[model samples]
Target: MIQTRVFPGWRVVAGAFVCMLTGYAVAYSFAAFFGPLEAEFGAQRGETSLVFSIAAFLYFLLGLPAGLVGDRVGPRPVVTGGLLIVALGLVIAAHASTLWQVYLGYSLGVGLGVGFSYVPSVTAVQHWFVRRRGTASGLAVAGIGVGTLIGAPLANALIARIGWRDTYLVLAALTVLGAGVAGLLIRRGPHFYGLEPDGEAAAAGKASPSSSGFTLAQAVRTGPFWAVYTAALLMSFGLFTPFVHLVPYVRDIGLGSGFGVLLITLLGVGSTVGRFLFASITPWLGRRLSFALMLIGAGVMLVVWSLSTSATALVFFALLFGAFYGGFVAIAPSLAADYFGGRALGAVIGALYSGVAFGALLGSPAAGYAYDFFGSYAGAILAGALLCFIAFTIMVLAPEPARWLTRRARSP
Candidate 1:
């Protein structure tokens, strides 16, 4: 009797999933901590929101280097080091006596930590699959939705029981244990194991030691690259505003904090579902088209969110917005892979996300400041909606890469 072993690619996907779940859970849990941190620090909404903005900005900006390094050195050491940094940041945040301390500890630490780990982990997944790339990518990033689902409420409950300071410590421990272990499971690519992508047996004539794909320099010069980058930048301006503000927004509308937490939870549930649901349909809808539709849908949802005052309306907004948001997150990498190939995908993806870093840096804080001035989030929400629409237009109008067009012209 012959025993057939499971493909190692699935293991890679599993590890990437856990890493994304743990890292993003820690990142998104800031919503649960928002009100408490504001009260504890005696800070304004803008100040409080800036912490999250800074962290988001740093992480996305650092992604370029992290991806570059991961491509060179592999993901394990980079991811493990990043997770440890997140733990340290959390520890410092737990001990914070001043708001500046929170910035120093949480903003820099968690920002840098997630930055180092996220791109590398996601990039590693791209190297492992071809046939099931969309599904695999969705599954790996679905950890983010699951993490958001678990992290926010868990933080809220823990803070209720143990206070915010101790809650940070608890999160720190969880990041170390969970993400640390997951990072170890990442391998560079299938070639390292004498296998091809999707676990196809390597044929003598077809075997390639390294992934075949565009280099960072070549990818950057393509029209599709800039289109994707521009769209990402615009979408991000609205994309993260809810994550940082939805809890507060619910409260501002006279809902209880618990209700706010519930909204965040619903967002997570929707996000998880969207990742699986959208990725499954990409083969038919096409990755680019699916992403464009989701972008427009997210924008429309923001308009609904701006007008929503009732709990029921807000619930609808959160679920649909989350689904669109999560779908795009899962699809973007696969789309990039479709255009650019996997050779230097980490760097290509990283470079594209650098646009997001700027948008995130501006978006959340701008919304917070708008609330401070206007005494409502209405203007910010509407502006976010407009940005999303513009992003959708840009994405839909963009042409395919010349290389892909040429390849198709030559194909039978």
Candidate 2:
């Protein structure tokens, strides 16, 4: 009888994908919930938006500690704990009677919860695969795009049928069910199962080389680290601004509510395609070049988006921009792994990803404030394009860490 073997790493990838998809779907559904929250609370755009910014800030900011915890204790516990906390946060938000309650329950709770799980999932995928790390990471993170694709329309439909509160309850249930299953399946690298990463026969011989690289302390001091960190921060500014504001902007520009939700879906579809497309070509173009080109593409698309006034123009912009944006996201984890070693990837990636926190803090509310002050999204959109261009420039010019370059030079 012939036996067929299933690689455990693929299971890890599947788990990460489910966790990311469900977590982001529930988290980003805030866009669909935005109008309802405002109507119920009688708050302005900027004020109501504080909840999401605070949540995202906590999510990205706390990812460092969460990653550290995952590094020390393992991913299973971290993901499980996060899933539970997210569920509780949603339940609390559903029952909240005051804006402060919403902030406390949803923003802080969900923020910390998601922070715990996000990096661990990404890091796990990196640990599981080497040659195909970009593809695996891209597949896992593509969940974010898929979540947005399904989540936006689902939330809108739920809001129309049942109330926003009930919609959140449904989301909470789904998040728990989906992520809990993932938590059970996710684990560290092949070492835990007494196998090698990628399950290759020669992986044992090359293991030491793969694990060699800067520790967290040493990595932080490198120029490449700062360059990537700053570029990620800048990228986040443009990336998240649209996630928070696009639906509202579409509405403001006279697209009906239904079309607004569909636009979000369109962006999701574009992003999904981009993530897969970019990741697939990373081996050919190299992560650095792939990321730089995608960043530039996104920046150009954002500029085009700003000129959009009609639904047709906006649709074109969404698909193009979303594809580029997704490509950028798909590359980040693999890029970090390339620049730094995979040994301390959890900590390094977490710290690098904190740029998302800072950028989200600035971008979302800034767009809201721009609208309130200027009565349009033009200025905010233009500013995001500029930031994306700046990020593209930084990524293109930055060299690999000197230590990494030296290591590569010394390698036979």
Candidate 3:
């Protein structure tokens, strides 16, 4: 159980928000430094993109172990350690002269920190709010958007004024304060605080045999796991492709940099709203149904994106499509927790996100190659639409976590 008992429930929520904002927010802002890194390091687009991919891969790759550690040792050390590593990575990146060094600092150091902080935050917060699980998780992950909102522009401004190297130093110090300090505060089970998880001020929490959820081994073997994995893979496949191309795509189509940046920001806002709002609405809609519907909606938007050109159309595309994609990020993990237990929640979500890392590996380069091969993004967008449809079909077939709970409840 979480140890500190001085604060109320909302305080926990606020802490979760701050931890997330610090952990994810600072790392995300690095994109604005991309041009500087490329100019200074003489890296190609593909190579620079891999820095993101590698960091992402490690971020998810370390998830399971972090989850196991969180379960056994409690989330506090994991989170605190993660924040420090992330902070160090930024500092290291600031001084690095080579592209490989940048990869080391960002992907290995900072990426590892993300696992320590991100998964534990989600799982721990899950312990705090059950009936309101959707909203709680929504709020927690919403920091990604909030972070993106604040981080993106700040990073851009910092890079322009202070140099990317100095910007990293400043951001690192901030992360140390925000994520590092907040993570040190995380407690394991809510019971230690004299309040049950989802009890009293929280309200209506239950633990069934089904609540044992899936062990990591069981999660690997289940059809439901694969179904969820496929859905996530497809969502991520479609998600990152556009991000990789957005700025260039707009410029290629003759939209000004100002407009291009606005469209990208719109996407972030759309996604943030989608994460919070769609997640809040998930219980009424049901998880699988909600995910499936979002998949279809995102697929439709992909088609729209392929045809869009004008500034207004691009902004609208980013707004709507971003919402669908962001909404998926918000809800997917809680869905995992509902199906699997909170015991290995970090690892399971980590593994799932690892698959998303693979999707990013596929999405960005594949989109680039496709454009080169076919001489158009048209083929690539069409391909993503087909994949999203397939993911939708899989979600339709997958059983709900509620059914799993009921089955366990009825058993001896």
Candidate 4:
């Protein structure tokens, strides 16, 4: 049992940090496996991209139920079970001999596992910190960026040292060791341990009002929810194109071989800085404007990228664009919590991210098809920028729900 004397919510944050780090690390590492899988499967780029889309699909699509379950039961069971599934998936992928088996074991298994763990970890953080939701969420989701940083280089190193097959096996062990222990430490909220959301200090003084926001059905009924969803869909559609294709895109641009995989590293570094930077300032800037600004910044970067000629230009574009993109990801949950209130935060966030999942599913393969058809990434890059601009427009025009404003007015 966690002690009541400590801020248990921070413990939840710590646990979530590890779970996200492990889960996303494994997912992003798919890029490292990309070349190997292409050779082994003898599949087209689009087809190979489908494997990731399928995994991402199940991961996001399942958020509705997973969030609902976490809201009702607890996050621990959901997360622990998901980590176990991740381990199983990695093990299956490690030994598979066919593409279908890879789809089944690696894509389906890891996707579902990540979905289960992700919603719960993110939602759990909101429950723990009402005053600092933005900061806490930034710290939590920063794991994805950090994992990308670690996972990309680590996966490449592992693949080089052993082999892709054995690499999966090693990942399986780490997933079980790191994520499993972290998942065990996570509890839903401070209330679970007989402490308040921000621990005894805030509880003894004036506790922030729990949000009286929309339930799932009512939330879906609103225009703002759909607007946010549309923006997310568009943003994700554009953003994932770079993430999935940047490595190959680098190689395609005639950059030296040494720099192909290093793009992920550069993007990771930029995102980490962006995540922390944005989270720290969001409280002052407000969620809506901050989000809109990030989107716009990212859009401009993409536009510049379409014209980049040299490797130096691409690297600079990648770092700046990745920073803006990372900041956007960190703020998403806070935006949801801000709009909907903290009542159904888990479920609302999960539903919102469903858009991200769908976007990735549609966007990545579409980008690949563009490459196959046009023989260049220029078309796709421009399309992504267009999507980001559209999302920024919606963010500027969209109105916040009355419930959220009322809660803010009441806050001390």
Candidate 5:
């Protein structure tokens, strides 16, 4: 009788999941803190929104270096170190005496920390599974949804009871404890253990090839790379506006603060469902089409959001938008892997994400400023919808990678 060992790659996926959940929970929790921080510092809406924007920009931008470093050094040290930085950032923000100090601590500290942690952790999972790549990637990033689901309301409740300053202290402690333990579960790819991807056994004295895909330089030269990058850039311009502004938008319309938080929570619920739901269908729908649909769906939902005024309409918009947004996040890494292959995948994914960094840097803050100028979020919301449609058009026009096309042709 032959005995089969449990695949160890799932453990890596679990670790990545926890890391994403912890990091993004802290990141998205910025919404819950927004009003309090404004009150504390006497800052305007645009200024307060900048804090989230700067942090989002840094983390995504930093993903490039972090991914490069992870490619060379492996993920464990990089992820663990990043989490520590997150804890430190939270701690610094807890004791901040001024708005700039919050920026220094939260924006830079959290940004750098999440940047170091997110890409490495996510990219590590790509090297472990081929057959279930979509599922694994979705499961891994679903943490973002779960974190958002929990983070906003938790922060709101905590702030109500313990106040905002001490809430940061509490969040700092949780980051160190939760993400730290999960990071320990991360290891190198299956090749490092004398095995093949998807838990297949290697022949005696042979390990899976780790150098099977495009090098970073080669990947950058390809048309598919630029297409994906440009599409991601356009999609992101409106992608994160809701995360930073949705709560305030609800409140501005006379819905209570609690209702605003509830909308965010519902968004999270929709996001988690979308990740799992879309990933489950990708093998049948094809990555390109599935991803394009996510963009279009999100665009349509944003249009609905822009028009929403009543609580019921807003609630309906939140769930669907979250679904599409979550699907976009879940599918992106796998799509990159399909296009570029796994060689230097961390760096490849990171470079692709740089598009998102620039868009996010401008998007959320611009939305806030638009609101300030117009005294309504309608213009910014509609603009976000337009960007999403443009992104979808780009994706639809972009050709599939030759390698991916060949693979599909060869398949039954």
Candidate 6:
């Protein structure tokens, strides 16, 4: 037997880091392609946005099913499969000559791959960590920002030098490499290793699986589920707006190409720091409170973005904004797990992301069309800020899981 005893917990956390690199970097980086893709495919700007929205729709829509598959098939194959599909999507995007072809390959194929890949990796992290859950989740998902940071600048550079198609051929190779390493390195951790849920000999203690878990049906029927999902929906709607457009928006305001690239990348830097900060702070504040605070912080940043005229101010804005947005990503799954059980955590988390899908549906095209409509990003910024406030409210009002879990633990 391949023993989970073969390695320490931190190693598994390391594996999660690699897994996210491929998923977030390549899968979500399609936003950077908007300008090139519109030109290369001879499509309208909105048509390009449609490609991202559809992919996002598939990303969210496919989460629960993929989670179910992760549970049964085990995360290994699902993750490896996702990486392979991402590579395939890249190759297909490289060869496509029409808008529909790009949509079919990129939106459908890569998007679906994200659905398959992301949760397995995330769930694996959750499965592994119990006491330091927030930190583990943060480190693992932080790859989303790091990979995104790498991909955007690299994609931009490649687009300038090699053209988008050939550039994708190179990225496809990297995608394959990323998946292979994950498959090789990430064996199921403590559970597979025959250790207890928490490490058996840790400084603190050990844990068993929660005796409580809601059936998928039961989870879907609740007020908390809808509230968290709604908040996430607004998050995706507005969050990716920055990921997809900050660079272009910077340019639109006369910062020029290089600064625009720096601005976009800066958001990623903020995201990285934000993830670490949330991981550090969540223990003190609790997951629900931390999430609410992040939402509020992000919403305020959106307002700042809407009104900025100077690059110096904008850069600072990108930093703080990136941090909190990154924090949201790291904490989200743990919050889901805290409220729900890991039993349906994947499915529920995936379902929650469907809001993100809806957000993607609206955010990308709306931003593009806003640019198309008013010749500035102001409309998009205002809309995102308003939605962020809505997300904050949803999160604030959503039921706290600790309340229920504490009651369950103490009663009888």
Instruction: List the global CA lDDT of all models.
Output: 0.89, 0.82, 0.74, 0.81, 0.88, 0.78
Candidate 5, superposed: residue stretches over 4 Å from native: 1-4, 204-209, 402-412
Poorly placed runs, candidate 2 (over 4 Å): 1-4, 202-210, 400-404, 407-412
Model 3: ten consecutive residues of lowest lDDT: 202-211
User: Model 6: per-residue lDDT, tens digit, 1-412?
Assistant: 2345543556656767888887777765665676788777677666677887787778777888888787776778888888889789888988998889888888877788878888877877777777878888888888887986777788878888998888888888988998898776554545555565456532234444522376678788878788888888887777777766776677678887577677767888889889998778888888887898888888889889888879888998889998998999899899888888766666678778777877887887888887877788887877887888888888887767889667756989
Per-residue alpha-carbon lDDT of model 5 for 1-412, expressed as tens digits?
A: 1134668888899999999899999998898999999999999889999999999999999888999999999999999899889999999999999999999999998899999999999999999988889999999999999998999999999999999999999999999986677778788888777777888877776535455788889889977788888888888888888889988998888997789889888888989999999988887878887898898898899889888889999899989888898899899999988887788899999999988999889999999888888888888878878888888898888776555558646999
Give the TM-score ranking, best first: 1, 5, 2, 4, 6, 3
Q: Quote each prediction's TM-score.
A: 0.96, 0.95, 0.89, 0.93, 0.96, 0.92
Top-lDDT structure, candidate number: 1
Model 4 Cα lDDT, one tens digit per residue, 1-412: 4655667777788888888888888888888887788889897778888778888877888887889898888899898888778888999999989888999888988899999998988888888877778778888888878887888789889998999999999999999986667776788666555555566543545444333566888889877788889888888777777667777777777884347568777778888889889878876767887888888888888888889878888889878887897899888887887788767777888898898888888888988888888898888888889989999999888775455467556999
The lDDT, on a scale of 0 to 1, for candidate 3 is 0.74
Give stretches of model 3 more than 4 Å off. Answer: 1-9, 201-211, 369-376, 408-412
Best candidate, TM-score: 1
Residue 408, candidate 1: alpha-carbon lDDT: 49
Residue pairs clashing in model 3 are 1-189, 2-187, 2-188
lDDT tens digits, residues 253-299, model 2? 78876787888888889988899988888877788878888878888
Worst 10 residues of 5 by lDDT: 203-212
lDDT of 6 at 289: 79
Q: Give the poorly placed runs of model 6, Cα more than 4 Å off.
A: 1-8, 201-207, 210-212, 408-412
- Per-prediction RMSD in angstroms? 2.3, 2.5, 3.2, 2.9, 2.8, 2.8
Higher-ranked by TM-score: 1 or 4: 1
lDDT of 5 at 192: 74
